[model samples]
Target: MVIFMLVKDVMKKPITVKDNDDLTEVIKLFREKRISGAPVLNDDGELVGIISESDIIKTLTTHDEDLNLILPSPLDLIELPLKTAIKIEEFKEDLKKALKTKVKDVMTKDVVVAKPDMTINDAAKLMVEHKIKRLPVVDEDGKLIGIITRGDIIEALV
Candidate 1:
């Protein structure tokens, strides 16, 4: 089952945003579409950065005091089981950031993008090395064509 699977078998068409797009618009898209992140593009549709809920949360919390009260920071919450603690800490960190933050500020600039033709194993290896959950599939010109998530990998493996 694994040998027969590849990234092309499960990748999703990527939704993207421009650098000039306001953070409000990004947040709206994420909420309405139930997406966590998107590829940031320029006028030419070149892949600029990747933005996610984590990015948006940073914009709201890090730069705004009032927004801070809107969500409880995990850092301020009581301790939890070890297994759940890891996920909780990550969530708390995202909640403590501000909205004025730019994609450049929060995005992983040294991104581990993938080619559509790459095998699933190749993508999985990159994911492990970079500690990322998704890969922005790019064309020869480095424009985003699709995206593959760890969920996609699990699906492929099964």
Candidate 2:
């Protein structure tokens, strides 16, 4: 009989971020580690949220303007120079806001998590159902211990 894998058996030690961490620092971590996302923890070491690349992109794109300038479209083609200038200005403002923002401001607070004893099959199902790439593994006390990703599951299966 094939024994099913458990989350703890496949999960890796998580790279986590504090709830109050600066978004700039988090971005640096993402680049340096080459990871797309991480689990967010509170001062008490409880998993409170998850931050992903999509979250960062969403935060940066939350501007008041329509921001849907399609280049080469008839209207934009007629005012190329003016449109270019306006886009550059908007880019500067958005960059400033992104740099100044905090992780807590953009993190998804309602994080879905996995238990150490959960079957890998169940964990994979959870990830698919939630449309998430990873799940923070928590112990009975609700403290983050490890994280399981789609890659981890794939590696185990193969």
Candidate 3:
């Protein structure tokens, strides 16, 4: 039986980010909220792109002739920085890097946005093919309305 439903009907409220936002801030939100991704919005609040943990991971470790140049090893990351040890200059530089990186830097700019009137099967198929856990639901105007995740699909299935 065909599940004839629009993505808007099942999508969750979106957690969004601006095009000029610091990716580091986004990362914190992801960790606290346990979400894999979020939508990126332009100044006019249009759907620009999507950013996922995998995207951030790519930035941290790019393939360089079979060598990886990752910053702050997993063990070192666990050691929380003391208040005094935190240098303002260093923090500022990191923030600058994140802002300059732009949403386009790590976001999936070639997006496969879901329209309100797509079948559940079609959406699921796209997600599977793209290896993405979520799909942003948008209107014809390219304005984001919500998002649908694998969890949402599973909940509907059961």
Better of 1 and 3 by lDDT: 3
Better of 1 and 3 by TM-score: 3
Off by over 4 Å in 1: 63-105
For candidate 2, lDDT tens digit of each residue in 97-131? 78778888989999999999999999999999999
Against the reference, the lDDT scores of all candidates come to: 0.74, 0.88, 0.77
User: What TM value does model 2 have?
Assistant: 0.83
Task: Give the Å shift of residue 126 in candidate 2.
Answer: 0.5
Q: How many backbone clashes does candidate 1 have?
A: 11
| TM-score, prediction 3 | 0.72
Residues 1-158, candidate 1: write the lDDT tens digits: 58556677789998787776767677778888878888888788788788877666655653323223335569644433453567556656765444444565666556679888888889989999988888999888887889998888888766
Clash tally, candidates in order: 11, 0, 0
Best to worst by TM-score, what's the order?
2, 3, 1
After superposition, which runs of candidate 3 have C-alpha atoms over 4 Å from their true positions?
A: 62-100
Clashes of 2: 0
Q: How does candidate 1 fare on TM-score?
A: 0.69
Ranking by lDDT: 2, 3, 1
My TM-score estimates for the predictions, one after another, are: 0.69, 0.83, 0.72
